[model samples]
Target: MPVWRRYLVRDASGRMVELPSRALDKAEDGTSPIPGFAGRCVDVVAAVLVAERGQSPQVAEVSFTKLYFDKSGFVDTGKRERMIRLMLESVADKRLARIPNAARAEAAVRAGAARLQLADEFAWQPGPAEMNEVMLRLDHRPAGQGHTVH
Candidate 1:
Protein backbone atom coordinates (compact mmCIF):
# COMPACT_ATOMS: atom_id res chain seq x y z
CA MET A 1 0.00 0.00 0.00
CA PRO A 2 1.14 3.58 -0.67
CA VAL A 3 0.28 6.77 1.19
CA TRP A 4 0.70 10.49 0.45
CA ARG A 5 1.34 12.98 3.25
CA ARG A 6 -0.72 16.15 2.70
CA TYR A 7 0.20 19.50 4.33
CA LEU A 8 -2.32 22.26 4.99
CA VAL A 9 -2.64 25.77 6.54
CA ARG A 10 -5.59 26.83 8.68
CA ASP A 11 -6.78 29.51 11.09
CA ALA A 12 -7.89 29.36 14.73
CA SER A 13 -11.58 28.95 13.81
CA GLY A 14 -10.71 25.75 11.86
CA ARG A 15 -12.80 26.33 8.73
CA MET A 16 -11.27 24.81 5.58
CA VAL A 17 -10.57 27.86 3.43
CA GLU A 18 -7.42 27.72 1.38
CA LEU A 19 -6.12 26.15 -1.79
CA PRO A 20 -2.42 25.54 -1.21
CA SER A 21 -1.57 23.71 -4.46
CA ARG A 22 -3.05 23.23 -7.90
CA ALA A 23 -4.00 20.01 -9.56
CA LEU A 24 -1.35 18.42 -11.79
CA ASP A 25 -3.85 16.41 -13.84
CA LYS A 26 -7.56 16.26 -14.51
CA ALA A 27 -9.66 13.15 -14.18
CA GLU A 28 -13.30 12.42 -14.98
CA ASP A 29 -14.28 12.96 -11.35
CA GLY A 30 -12.21 16.14 -11.25
CA THR A 31 -9.67 14.61 -8.88
CA SER A 32 -6.82 16.86 -9.94
CA PRO A 33 -8.40 19.63 -11.87
CA ILE A 34 -6.36 22.79 -12.71
CA PRO A 35 -2.63 22.55 -13.36
CA GLY A 36 -1.60 24.97 -10.65
CA PHE A 37 -2.45 25.65 -7.03
CA ALA A 38 -6.21 26.10 -7.29
CA GLY A 39 -7.95 23.12 -5.78
CA ARG A 40 -9.21 21.78 -2.45
CA CYS A 41 -6.31 20.11 -0.60
CA VAL A 42 -6.94 22.30 2.43
CA ASP A 43 -10.48 21.01 2.68
CA VAL A 44 -9.13 17.53 3.07
CA VAL A 45 -6.87 18.62 5.90
CA ALA A 46 -9.71 20.53 7.54
CA ALA A 47 -11.79 17.40 7.58
CA VAL A 48 -8.93 15.61 9.29
CA LEU A 49 -8.66 18.35 11.87
CA VAL A 50 -12.37 18.22 12.50
CA ALA A 51 -12.21 14.47 12.98
CA GLU A 52 -9.30 14.83 15.38
CA ARG A 53 -10.88 17.64 17.36
CA GLY A 54 -14.20 15.77 17.58
CA GLN A 55 -16.18 19.01 17.34
CA SER A 56 -16.46 22.15 15.28
CA PRO A 57 -14.35 25.16 16.20
CA GLN A 58 -15.06 28.86 16.03
CA VAL A 59 -12.68 29.46 13.13
CA ALA A 60 -13.92 31.27 10.04
CA GLU A 61 -14.49 29.43 6.77
CA VAL A 62 -11.35 28.55 4.81
CA SER A 63 -10.58 27.03 1.42
CA PHE A 64 -8.63 23.81 0.96
CA THR A 65 -5.61 23.55 -1.32
CA LYS A 66 -2.77 21.16 -2.06
CA LEU A 67 0.59 22.37 -0.76
CA TYR A 68 2.52 19.44 -2.23
CA PHE A 69 2.45 15.79 -3.10
CA ASP A 70 4.50 13.90 -0.50
CA LYS A 71 4.83 10.57 -2.21
CA SER A 72 5.45 7.25 -0.49
CA GLY A 73 6.34 5.14 -3.54
CA PHE A 74 5.02 3.80 -6.82
CA VAL A 75 2.69 0.87 -6.67
CA ASP A 76 0.19 -0.50 -9.23
CA THR A 77 -0.79 2.14 -11.78
CA GLY A 78 -3.92 0.41 -12.98
CA LYS A 79 -5.35 0.03 -9.51
CA ARG A 80 -4.35 3.54 -8.58
CA GLU A 81 -6.05 5.10 -11.58
CA ARG A 82 -9.24 3.20 -10.96
CA MET A 83 -9.24 4.18 -7.33
CA ILE A 84 -8.67 7.84 -8.07
CA ARG A 85 -11.43 7.91 -10.62
CA LEU A 86 -13.83 6.21 -8.27
CA MET A 87 -13.07 8.49 -5.37
CA LEU A 88 -13.44 11.63 -7.45
CA GLU A 89 -16.72 10.44 -8.84
CA SER A 90 -17.96 9.65 -5.41
CA VAL A 91 -17.14 13.09 -4.10
CA ALA A 92 -18.45 14.87 -7.15
CA ASP A 93 -21.75 13.06 -7.07
CA LYS A 94 -22.25 13.59 -3.37
CA ARG A 95 -24.53 16.45 -2.32
CA LEU A 96 -21.78 18.44 -0.68
CA ALA A 97 -23.41 21.80 -1.32
CA ARG A 98 -25.78 21.26 1.59
CA ILE A 99 -23.46 19.27 3.80
CA PRO A 100 -21.90 20.71 6.93
CA ASN A 101 -18.36 21.97 7.04
CA ALA A 102 -17.04 18.82 8.67
CA ALA A 103 -18.79 16.59 6.18
CA ARG A 104 -17.38 18.61 3.33
CA ALA A 105 -13.90 18.04 4.73
CA GLU A 106 -14.52 14.32 4.75
CA ALA A 107 -15.57 14.53 1.14
CA ALA A 108 -12.26 16.15 0.30
CA VAL A 109 -10.45 13.20 1.86
CA ARG A 110 -12.36 10.82 -0.34
CA ALA A 111 -11.47 12.92 -3.34
CA GLY A 112 -7.79 13.10 -2.30
CA ALA A 113 -7.67 9.35 -1.85
CA ALA A 114 -8.60 9.00 -5.47
CA ARG A 115 -5.98 11.52 -6.54
CA LEU A 116 -3.32 9.71 -4.54
CA GLN A 117 -4.37 6.49 -6.20
CA LEU A 118 -3.70 7.95 -9.61
CA ALA A 119 -0.35 9.31 -8.47
CA ASP A 120 0.71 5.88 -7.23
CA GLU A 121 0.27 4.47 -10.70
CA PHE A 122 3.37 6.22 -12.02
CA ALA A 123 6.51 4.12 -12.37
CA TRP A 124 9.65 4.91 -10.45
CA GLN A 125 12.22 5.75 -13.13
CA PRO A 126 13.21 9.39 -12.75
CA GLY A 127 16.56 10.51 -11.36
CA PRO A 128 17.09 12.58 -8.22
CA ALA A 129 17.67 15.75 -10.22
CA GLU A 130 14.48 15.24 -12.17
CA MET A 131 12.55 14.49 -9.00
CA ASN A 132 14.00 17.60 -7.40
CA GLU A 133 12.88 19.63 -10.34
CA VAL A 134 9.29 18.43 -9.91
CA MET A 135 9.47 19.13 -6.21
CA LEU A 136 10.74 22.64 -6.77
CA ARG A 137 8.34 23.40 -9.59
CA LEU A 138 5.17 21.78 -8.25
CA ASP A 139 5.92 21.32 -4.58
CA HIS A 140 5.49 17.60 -5.11
CA ARG A 141 7.92 15.37 -3.22
CA PRO A 142 8.27 11.98 -4.90
CA ALA A 143 7.36 8.96 -2.83
CA GLY A 144 9.74 6.17 -3.87
CA GLN A 145 13.51 6.56 -3.58
CA GLY A 146 14.05 6.77 -7.35
CA HIS A 147 10.53 7.81 -8.35
CA THR A 148 9.70 11.25 -9.74
CA VAL A 149 6.41 13.15 -9.99
CA HIS A 150 5.09 13.37 -13.52
Candidate 2:
Protein backbone atom coordinates (compact mmCIF):
# COMPACT_ATOMS: atom_id res chain seq x y z
CA MET A 1 0.00 0.00 0.00
CA PRO A 2 1.15 3.54 -0.68
CA VAL A 3 1.96 5.68 2.28
CA TRP A 4 -0.18 8.77 2.60
CA ARG A 5 1.16 12.13 3.73
CA ARG A 6 -1.10 14.67 5.42
CA TYR A 7 -0.32 18.39 5.44
CA LEU A 8 -1.48 20.40 8.43
CA VAL A 9 -1.26 23.70 10.31
CA ARG A 10 -2.44 25.17 13.58
CA ASP A 11 -5.11 27.73 14.28
CA ALA A 12 -4.71 30.65 16.63
CA SER A 13 -6.14 28.50 19.41
CA GLY A 14 -3.52 25.84 18.66
CA ARG A 15 -5.95 23.47 16.99
CA MET A 16 -4.63 21.38 14.14
CA VAL A 17 -6.03 22.24 10.73
CA GLU A 18 -5.72 19.62 8.02
CA LEU A 19 -5.05 20.53 4.38
CA PRO A 20 -5.20 18.67 1.08
CA SER A 21 -2.10 16.60 0.56
CA ARG A 22 -1.78 17.13 -3.17
CA ALA A 23 -3.32 20.47 -4.03
CA LEU A 24 -1.45 20.83 -7.35
CA ASP A 25 0.31 18.75 -9.94
CA LYS A 26 2.71 19.40 -12.80
CA ALA A 27 1.35 19.13 -16.32
CA GLU A 28 2.58 16.30 -18.53
CA ASP A 29 4.39 18.85 -20.66
CA GLY A 30 6.33 20.08 -17.61
CA THR A 31 4.67 23.46 -17.58
CA SER A 32 2.03 24.48 -15.05
CA PRO A 33 0.57 27.93 -14.65
CA ILE A 34 0.36 27.41 -10.94
CA PRO A 35 3.64 26.68 -9.24
CA GLY A 36 4.26 23.32 -7.59
CA PHE A 37 4.04 24.67 -4.03
CA ALA A 38 0.71 26.34 -4.53
CA GLY A 39 -1.85 25.19 -1.96
CA ARG A 40 0.66 23.02 -0.14
CA CYS A 41 1.82 25.44 2.50
CA VAL A 42 0.53 24.63 5.95
CA ASP A 43 -0.02 28.27 6.92
CA VAL A 44 -1.92 29.10 3.74
CA VAL A 45 -3.98 25.95 4.09
CA ALA A 46 -4.85 26.76 7.69
CA ALA A 47 -5.70 30.31 6.74
CA VAL A 48 -8.05 29.13 4.00
CA LEU A 49 -9.87 26.84 6.43
CA VAL A 50 -10.19 29.55 9.08
CA ALA A 51 -11.31 32.18 6.63
CA GLU A 52 -13.81 29.76 5.15
CA ARG A 53 -15.29 29.38 8.61
CA GLY A 54 -15.53 33.17 8.86
CA GLN A 55 -12.97 33.23 11.62
CA SER A 56 -9.69 35.01 12.09
CA PRO A 57 -6.47 33.71 10.56
CA GLN A 58 -4.26 34.43 13.54
CA VAL A 59 -2.65 31.06 13.20
CA ALA A 60 -0.23 29.66 15.72
CA GLU A 61 3.57 29.88 15.47
CA VAL A 62 3.96 26.78 13.33
CA SER A 63 5.86 27.06 10.08
CA PHE A 64 8.78 25.68 8.02
CA THR A 65 7.42 22.11 7.90
CA LYS A 66 4.24 20.44 6.77
CA LEU A 67 2.90 17.20 8.25
CA TYR A 68 3.32 13.84 6.58
CA PHE A 69 1.81 10.41 7.15
CA ASP A 70 4.35 7.92 8.45
CA LYS A 71 7.02 10.41 7.46
CA SER A 72 6.55 9.71 3.74
CA GLY A 73 4.08 10.38 0.92
CA PHE A 74 3.52 11.79 -2.53
CA VAL A 75 3.30 15.44 -3.55
CA ASP A 76 1.48 16.46 -6.73
CA THR A 77 1.41 19.87 -8.37
CA GLY A 78 -0.89 20.79 -11.26
CA LYS A 79 -4.26 22.32 -11.96
CA ARG A 80 -5.65 22.36 -8.43
CA GLU A 81 -9.28 23.36 -8.85
CA ARG A 82 -10.58 19.82 -8.96
CA MET A 83 -8.58 18.74 -5.92
CA ILE A 84 -9.70 21.77 -3.96
CA ARG A 85 -13.31 21.03 -4.83
CA LEU A 86 -12.93 17.42 -3.88
CA MET A 87 -11.32 18.36 -0.59
CA LEU A 88 -14.11 20.73 0.26
CA GLU A 89 -16.65 18.08 -0.55
CA SER A 90 -14.93 15.41 1.51
CA VAL A 91 -13.71 17.42 4.49
CA ALA A 92 -15.13 16.27 7.81
CA ASP A 93 -15.91 19.82 8.85
CA LYS A 94 -18.97 20.86 6.91
CA ARG A 95 -18.32 24.50 7.72
CA LEU A 96 -15.33 24.60 5.37
CA ALA A 97 -17.49 23.34 2.54
CA ARG A 98 -19.27 26.67 2.23
CA ILE A 99 -16.75 28.31 -0.16
CA PRO A 100 -18.39 26.48 -3.17
CA ASN A 101 -15.30 26.63 -5.40
CA ALA A 102 -11.51 26.75 -5.49
CA ALA A 103 -11.48 30.39 -6.49
CA ARG A 104 -13.44 31.29 -3.39
CA ALA A 105 -11.14 29.23 -1.29
CA GLU A 106 -8.19 31.04 -2.79
CA ALA A 107 -9.88 34.32 -2.04
CA ALA A 108 -10.18 33.23 1.55
CA VAL A 109 -6.49 32.51 1.53
CA ARG A 110 -5.81 36.03 0.35
CA ALA A 111 -8.10 37.44 2.98
CA GLY A 112 -6.40 35.41 5.62
CA ALA A 113 -3.07 36.64 4.38
CA ALA A 114 -4.25 40.19 4.74
CA ARG A 115 -5.41 39.41 8.23
CA LEU A 116 -2.00 38.02 9.01
CA GLN A 117 -0.36 41.20 7.78
CA LEU A 118 1.81 39.50 5.22
CA ALA A 119 3.36 41.74 2.58
CA ASP A 120 1.11 42.51 -0.39
CA GLU A 121 3.28 40.54 -2.77
CA PHE A 122 3.17 37.32 -0.73
CA ALA A 123 -0.38 37.80 0.44
CA TRP A 124 -1.93 37.53 -3.00
CA GLN A 125 -1.40 33.81 -3.64
CA PRO A 126 -0.19 30.44 -2.42
CA GLY A 127 3.25 29.60 -3.77
CA PRO A 128 6.86 29.25 -2.68
CA ALA A 129 7.15 33.00 -2.37
CA GLU A 130 4.17 33.20 -0.05
CA MET A 131 5.32 30.14 1.84
CA ASN A 132 8.75 31.64 2.44
CA GLU A 133 7.29 34.93 3.55
CA VAL A 134 4.86 33.24 5.91
CA MET A 135 7.52 30.98 7.31
CA LEU A 136 9.75 33.94 7.98
CA ARG A 137 6.90 35.80 9.61
CA LEU A 138 5.78 32.93 11.83
CA ASP A 139 9.13 31.43 12.66
CA HIS A 140 9.87 33.09 15.97
CA ARG A 141 11.55 30.25 17.79
CA PRO A 142 14.33 27.88 16.85
CA ALA A 143 13.70 25.06 14.42
CA GLY A 144 13.09 22.41 17.14
CA GLN A 145 11.10 24.50 19.55
CA GLY A 146 7.44 24.14 18.54
CA HIS A 147 5.38 21.22 17.26
CA THR A 148 7.44 18.66 15.38
CA VAL A 149 6.49 17.93 11.77
CA HIS A 150 7.02 14.45 10.37
Candidate 3:
Protein backbone atom coordinates (compact mmCIF):
# COMPACT_ATOMS: atom_id res chain seq x y z
CA MET A 1 0.00 0.00 0.00
CA PRO A 2 1.11 3.52 -0.69
CA VAL A 3 1.71 5.76 2.29
CA TRP A 4 0.36 9.27 2.43
CA ARG A 5 1.55 12.02 4.70
CA ARG A 6 -0.28 15.19 5.69
CA TYR A 7 1.80 18.31 5.17
CA LEU A 8 0.84 21.56 6.91
CA VAL A 9 1.61 25.17 6.14
CA ARG A 10 1.00 27.87 8.71
CA ASP A 11 0.55 31.55 8.06
CA ALA A 12 2.27 34.34 9.96
CA SER A 13 -0.69 34.27 12.31
CA GLY A 14 -0.10 30.52 12.87
CA ARG A 15 -3.23 29.25 11.16
CA MET A 16 -2.51 25.89 9.51
CA VAL A 17 -3.38 25.13 5.90
CA GLU A 18 -3.31 21.63 4.48
CA LEU A 19 -1.93 21.29 0.98
CA PRO A 20 -2.91 18.69 -1.57
CA SER A 21 -0.09 16.30 -2.52
CA ARG A 22 -0.20 17.66 -6.06
CA ALA A 23 0.63 21.19 -4.92
CA LEU A 24 4.09 20.13 -3.81
CA ASP A 25 5.01 18.88 -7.28
CA LYS A 26 3.74 22.04 -8.91
CA ALA A 27 5.73 24.22 -6.58
CA GLU A 28 8.91 22.36 -7.52
CA ASP A 29 8.33 22.99 -11.19
CA GLY A 30 8.54 26.73 -10.58
CA THR A 31 5.54 27.07 -12.86
CA SER A 32 2.93 27.66 -10.19
CA PRO A 33 3.06 30.42 -7.62
CA ILE A 34 3.58 29.18 -4.11
CA PRO A 35 0.26 29.13 -2.34
CA GLY A 36 1.50 31.54 0.35
CA PHE A 37 4.23 31.90 2.91
CA ALA A 38 2.78 29.16 5.06
CA GLY A 39 2.52 26.72 2.22
CA ARG A 40 6.03 27.55 1.26
CA CYS A 41 7.17 26.98 4.81
CA VAL A 42 5.58 23.55 4.81
CA ASP A 43 7.40 22.76 1.59
CA VAL A 44 10.73 23.45 3.27
CA VAL A 45 9.78 21.14 6.08
CA ALA A 46 9.02 18.41 3.59
CA ALA A 47 12.34 18.86 1.84
CA VAL A 48 14.21 18.52 5.08
CA LEU A 49 12.38 15.30 5.69
CA VAL A 50 13.33 13.95 2.32
CA ALA A 51 16.98 14.84 2.69
CA GLU A 52 17.42 13.39 6.14
CA ARG A 53 15.57 10.21 5.31
CA GLY A 54 17.70 9.67 2.19
CA GLN A 55 14.47 9.40 0.24
CA SER A 56 13.98 10.40 -3.35
CA PRO A 57 11.97 13.57 -3.76
CA GLN A 58 8.43 12.45 -3.72
CA VAL A 59 6.30 15.06 -5.44
CA ALA A 60 5.42 16.54 -2.08
CA GLU A 61 9.00 16.65 -0.91
CA VAL A 62 10.52 18.36 -3.95
CA SER A 63 7.80 20.97 -3.98
CA PHE A 64 8.52 22.03 -0.43
CA THR A 65 12.27 22.38 -1.01
CA LYS A 66 11.75 24.27 -4.24
CA LEU A 67 9.42 26.76 -2.63
CA TYR A 68 11.79 27.24 0.28
CA PHE A 69 14.83 27.90 -1.87
CA ASP A 70 12.92 30.16 -4.21
CA LYS A 71 11.57 32.34 -1.43
CA SER A 72 14.52 32.35 0.92
CA GLY A 73 17.07 32.61 -1.85
CA PHE A 74 20.64 31.62 -1.00
CA VAL A 75 22.86 32.27 1.96
CA ASP A 76 24.94 35.49 2.34
CA THR A 77 21.78 36.92 3.88
CA GLY A 78 21.48 37.26 7.63
CA LYS A 79 18.28 35.27 8.03
CA ARG A 80 19.51 32.25 6.10
CA GLU A 81 22.82 32.32 7.89
CA ARG A 82 21.15 32.49 11.26
CA MET A 83 18.88 29.62 10.36
CA ILE A 84 21.86 27.45 9.50
CA ARG A 85 23.57 28.46 12.72
CA LEU A 86 20.49 27.57 14.68
CA MET A 87 20.21 24.25 12.90
CA LEU A 88 23.80 23.42 13.73
CA GLU A 89 23.25 24.38 17.34
CA SER A 90 20.19 22.18 17.56
CA VAL A 91 22.09 19.24 16.15
CA ALA A 92 24.75 19.64 18.79
CA ASP A 93 22.33 19.57 21.66
CA LYS A 94 22.60 16.48 23.80
CA ARG A 95 18.87 16.02 23.82
CA LEU A 96 18.96 15.39 20.10
CA ALA A 97 21.10 12.32 20.61
CA ARG A 98 18.27 10.65 22.40
CA ILE A 99 16.00 11.01 19.40
CA PRO A 100 17.44 7.99 17.54
CA ASN A 101 17.28 9.30 13.96
CA ALA A 102 17.90 12.25 11.68
CA ALA A 103 14.30 12.56 10.50
CA ARG A 104 13.10 13.97 13.81
CA ALA A 105 15.98 16.42 13.87
CA GLU A 106 15.17 17.57 10.36
CA ALA A 107 11.53 18.05 11.34
CA ALA A 108 12.53 20.08 14.36
CA VAL A 109 14.75 22.32 12.26
CA ARG A 110 11.97 22.89 9.74
CA ALA A 111 9.42 23.76 12.42
CA GLY A 112 11.82 25.99 14.29
CA ALA A 113 12.82 27.83 11.14
CA ALA A 114 9.20 28.38 10.23
CA ARG A 115 8.41 29.69 13.69
CA LEU A 116 11.32 32.08 13.44
CA GLN A 117 10.48 33.00 9.85
CA LEU A 118 14.04 32.18 8.91
CA ALA A 119 15.04 32.02 5.29
CA ASP A 120 15.64 28.61 3.72
CA GLU A 121 18.56 28.28 1.37
CA PHE A 122 20.21 25.36 -0.41
CA ALA A 123 22.39 24.81 2.63
CA TRP A 124 20.55 21.59 3.29
CA GLN A 125 21.08 20.14 -0.15
CA PRO A 126 22.99 16.84 0.03
CA GLY A 127 24.99 16.07 -3.03
CA PRO A 128 27.52 13.23 -3.22
CA ALA A 129 30.31 15.44 -2.01
CA GLU A 130 28.22 16.72 0.83
CA MET A 131 27.22 13.22 1.84
CA ASN A 132 30.83 12.17 1.76
CA GLU A 133 31.76 15.07 3.98
CA VAL A 134 29.02 14.14 6.39
CA MET A 135 30.09 10.55 6.51
CA LEU A 136 33.71 11.49 7.04
CA ARG A 137 32.76 13.78 9.88
CA LEU A 138 30.56 11.15 11.41
CA ASP A 139 33.38 8.61 11.19
CA HIS A 140 35.46 10.79 13.47
CA ARG A 141 32.74 11.09 16.07
CA PRO A 142 31.82 8.45 18.64
CA ALA A 143 29.66 5.66 17.40
CA GLY A 144 26.01 6.64 17.07
CA GLN A 145 26.79 10.34 17.34
CA GLY A 146 26.61 12.31 14.13
CA HIS A 147 25.61 15.86 13.35
CA THR A 148 22.31 16.42 11.62
CA VAL A 149 22.92 17.94 8.18
CA HIS A 150 19.37 18.59 7.05
- Candidate number with greatest TM-score: 3
State the lDDT at 36 in candidate 3. Answer: 53
- Please report the candidate that would top lDDT against the real structure: 3
* Tens digit of per-residue lDDT, candidate 2, span 17-51: 55443442222223332333333433333321112
lDDT per residue as tens, model 1, 1-150: 222333233333643233333322232234544333232222123211111233322212222322223132122244445555665655652657777888788887786765555444422333455334323432322344232222
TM-scores of the models, in the order given: 0.24, 0.20, 0.30
Q: Give the C-alpha miss distance for residue 129 in model 3, angstroms.
A: 38
Instruction: Give the alpha carbon lDDT tens digit for every residue of 62-135 in model 3.
Output: 22232343452221234445666765654453445566577667767666665344334433344565345334
Query: Whole-model Cα lDDT per candidate?
Result: 0.38, 0.38, 0.42
Q: What is the lDDT of residue 116 in candidate 1?
A: 58
Backbone clash numbers for all candidates listed: 20, 6, 1
Indicate the residue-level lDDT of 29 in model 3: 51
| Model 1, C-alpha of 64: deviation from truth (Å) | 25
